[model samples]
Target chain A: METLAELEPGKSPDVPQVLPPEPVVEIKASRTWLALNLKEIWAYRELLYFLTWRDVKVRYKQTLLGVVWVVLQPLMTMVITTIFFGKIVRVPSDNLPYALFVFAGLLPWMFFSKAITQSGSSLVGSANLITKVYFPRLIIPSATVLSGLVDYAVSVVVLIGLMIYYGVGASVHLLMFPVLIVLMTILALGVGMWLSALNVKYRDVAAMIPFLVQVGMFATPVYYPSSLIPEKWQWLMKLNPLTGIVENSRAALFNRPFDWLSFNISVGIAVLLLVSSAYVFRRMEKSFADFV
Target chain B: MQSIITVENVSKQYRLGTRDASYGTLRDSIVRSIRAPFSKSQSKKGNGVETIWALKDVGFEVKPGEVVGIIGRNGAGKSTLLKILARIVEPTTGNIKLYGRVGSLLEVGTGFHPELSGRENIYLNGAILGMKRAEIERKFDEIVAFAEIEKFIDTPVKHYSSGMYMRLAFAVAAHLEPEILIVDEVLAVGDAGFQKKCLEKMRDVGEHGRTVLFVSHNMSAITRLCKRAILLGDGQVLADGTAHKVASSYLNSGLGTTAVREWQDLEKAPGNDIVRLYAIRVVDEDGQLTDVVDIRKPIGLEMEYAVLNPYHILVPNYHFYTEEGVCAFVAQELDEHWRTTPRPLGRYKSTVWVPGNFLSEGTMIVGAAISTMDPVTIHFHEQDAVAFQVVDSLDGNSSRGDYAGHMPGVVRPMLQWHTEYHVKEN
Candidate 1:
């Protein structure tokens, strides 16, 4: 039992083993509606680079397949989604091949979910770095988001292969893909910022997040297409920003007409959350070293 | 010179034990909010029951190139003051303004990733210690040289020896050339040689005109590094002046120190039933107790113990160590009568005199021991049981010869030198 307790994460009493990885710092407990400091984050941009680099390096250090698992993770998930929802449930694929449909939707969902899960726990995981140095605290979770891009790129290669197998090609409308990626990242960052901050104070969020992400996978159309849902309820689905991203990821993969209306709403909500959640993070950051 | 750092009326208050349960869920927060109105905390009048003022209304100014030592016992706010100066944590009230780029070695190896190679960790740890990328690149060779890990620069630090790891950490910290350096007991790690090297590096940093705020409980180190010292007690500044004056005062003000210590309780005495230590003392030749012994006079360490089961040959010994951790000597009862014969059960007293003009002027920690060499076993050993100061008048009769510029030695024994008149012919 003693050994078991010692094996617990964040239980190490040593200095270095217990602090959160950090890249910037500010001290204030303000009541301001928004307190995001772009300048501070800008100043620590090099540290941000190192943090992202550290995460990317440490992730695959000892794994036998190394970075191959990056592509493999999404590929396996896509196959499972194809079997369960595409074959058994027989979700409508909007005149597209079922394999192609599910993979496209899974790409954005995978990116968003991985980014959110990693970044959401990033602050708490970086307990060792946070307590020791003075850096912009926002960099930890943001760096997590940045590192997820590596895995996302690997998975995108698999997606491109699926596209070729299905004989689908991209048009100029595919240019919106990067914009969609950016919106998805911002959405992840916004929620991740909120969750990471809350996780610092109440670690119950750490236990709650994986369950939420699982439920969120089903809520968003990863395997099933949005068209399969009735039209009346489709408006409510758009409120979840992942719905817009996954649908457009499919459109971008197939070069369909961009849904500018839902896309605009999604980007707007993403930007709004990114701003406000960053504010909440900054506000709580003052007591982070004290409490974390 | 203008002051490079100014702090005024700084105080830090912390809630005791609040950290454990501070991380409650959203539902708990909601419950707390709903119960707030009906709570009776207002009737308690904010009396600070759970509050601890780690630092209270403290103020100081540090000029560029002034190395200041903060001396205190545990929980005396030394660390809190250093943290505030480093901006690691903010004071509850008041403000501190630092004029230049600040670097702090609050803990060594702040972010040395064990998975990374030594070379990579150098950059990572350097950046964490406030070195920019280019700055680290420039000092790369010097850091490797200082750490003496050039051969293993490409190896992962997880495989390095603990000493090597500490050297790498301290090397990165020591190489940081910030305008103001803040350190907190970082020298406490590493071996003695490494500690000496670190002190030398800190001395070099001081010579480069960087203002330094060094916090430490190591008084000898405090005296060696700084010209000024601040003594903190119970969250307040008790003394602030020259390093020698303040350091000695801090030592004198500490608890659990005396010229004599006695244990009357039989069960609590520092020994087994076979032999229980009754008392120990630092006494002058007249047997009167004293802490300060002159260089020309022999001082005595007296020990009295009760022997229950006799017919056992025992050695009453004391190990003396200087404050700088140099062993002075180990003395024990080695009389021929006691060496070859057993004694009857009775109370025994022993006094060992440190010869006159032997010890240097400083504090010496005495460790008392009672042991039987037949089985090579120690019955009892008390580390740092008592300590005393040695003094010299510089009257030209003893080792410190009428000259003084910080006499350096573990033993200042007066030695004789002879000169013959026949030497004039040469």
Candidate 2:
């Protein structure tokens, strides 16, 4: 068993220079509607870093091919999806090769989907940690979303590989890729925050999330371009948020013109969802330990 | 010393079974919507809400540099109060003001991932405990040394022994320099020597002008480490005074004429589907029920229970605690005949005998338990379930030998000592 050295009184070295601890940590029964408590989250930011780091570390530990699984997952999914939906079903790829087209859509979709599922279940997964300590509970889901960025980064390499394989050139519009990635993460966090908060009280949220993700995969343009949809219905598809994100990211990825209208709508919706779900998460975080 | 924590009229009520009127499932919403107009008369139950006030108008203020102990039985809201103070759970009504950073140790090693190495987990657990990255970095070597897992610092914690895991977990938690520390019954874990060290560290934390709120069923800990101890009963502050007064009051409350307990109402009995405690009592050498036993004669504790689930092997045990909350001994029957066999669901009675001339003459609180091994899970554990007193009547037969002032130990075992005289060879 690991045993710490027992420090002798007054003589032992390594006495910590005690900084004045945080002042006035008031725990109340209720707070205002917008008590996001961002400052508290800011103070615990290193916790956010460590939690995200732990997720990334634990995910690939002891695996035969550790982080290669990250790239392999999306690459394989894109292959199977392109063969079935493109080769057999003959879905139009908007003049792009079917492999490159599906891979582009799958990029944001993989990041968004993984982030949603991960952050959605993050609270219940950390039930041990939650009941045992105190922190801004928002850190949990956000950290899960952040860690998914690791896999997202790996998968993006495969996407770029496929694009280059098909002779597609990168444009100045690629500068928008990082911004689109952030928007997709915010969107995932928004939905994840809502679902994880709901998951504590009703386990039904966890069970229902897979179905929601499956339906969302088809609802977005993972298999088919939004151009395949009739013009009248593209606005409804844009309402799904991923439509603008994935299509816009692909436009940037393929050096195509950006859809400023639908893309701006998606950004606005992502920000709104992020803010509202954050409010809802804070509202329900108080009861999490009791229920979870 | 200024008041570090002020809980004002704080009360927390929880719904009996489910979260009330929140997060209703699709099935529930669909059923409720279909039955809405027709079930209006029955809906008067209003979310079918039955609530228990885990805390009720409970209020207290503790000064900085003071160590306060909260003592209560299970369901007495001690855990609830700690959760409230820790902000793990919120009060249903009222408010609390804490004027310093709070580190809550509801359990040790809250965020230790099994797959992570010890070095990584130390940082992760420290961060979870509210320590800054710099703070953890400064104390990293000390934590690794304290956990005594220096050799295994880079090894995965999943392979660490339970002792090593607990040591590391506790080392991280103890080093967190929060202005206020809230600890629960986590001290009940780890071996005796380590627990003594932890208690000593807690004392140091208190003496360093940081406030500590410790909740435990361990009476000795409460009495030794706390200046003011609060006794909670049914979510209310029953008594608040010096540790001796409060602990003695709690022990005395267990002593009044209720050695044998029986519950006719199965629903109200303190058990789950796994096992239900039917009856329990302390008896004399003759196997007759009694609360007071002669110190010179053997005494037996009998616990009868109905095993509701027959699948799991169950071991019924007893923890005998002296009046000061120190465990004298834990006795469980090892009837090998029944060890490997599965018994059908039925009522079973198990009696453990305590030999004569063993126990100190004092009130002993019995904690009865039924649990399964291998996975090591408790089916039902009831603390202070029964109490009995042993009397040494100056018979000169036991170890007391008429030393009338005070018996200082938990058990006054009668040991035979042989002596040989030798000439001094200077």
Best candidate per TM-score, number? 1
Q: lDDT of model 1 at residue A204? A: 81
CAPRI accuracy category, model 1: incorrect
Q: What lDDT tens digits, residue by residue, belong to model 2 across residues A192-245?
A: 899889888777888998999999998998889888899999789888989989
Report the lDDT tens digits of candidate 2 across residue range B334-369. Answer: 889666665569999999989988887666889999
Determine which window of 10 residues in candidate 1 chain B has minimal summed lDDT: B40-49
Q: In candidate 2, which residue pairs clash?
A: A2-B147, A2-B148, A2-B149, A3-B146, A3-B147, A3-B148, A4-B145, A4-B146
**iRMS for all predictions?**
15.2, 6.8
TM agreement with the true structure for every prediction: 0.81, 0.80
Q: After superposition, how far is residue B66 of candidate 2 from its true place, in Å?
A: 0.6
TM-score of chain A of 1: 0.87
Candidate 1 wrong stretches, greater than 4 Å: A1-34, B17-22, B38-49, B255-404, B412-426
TM-score of chain B of 2: 0.70
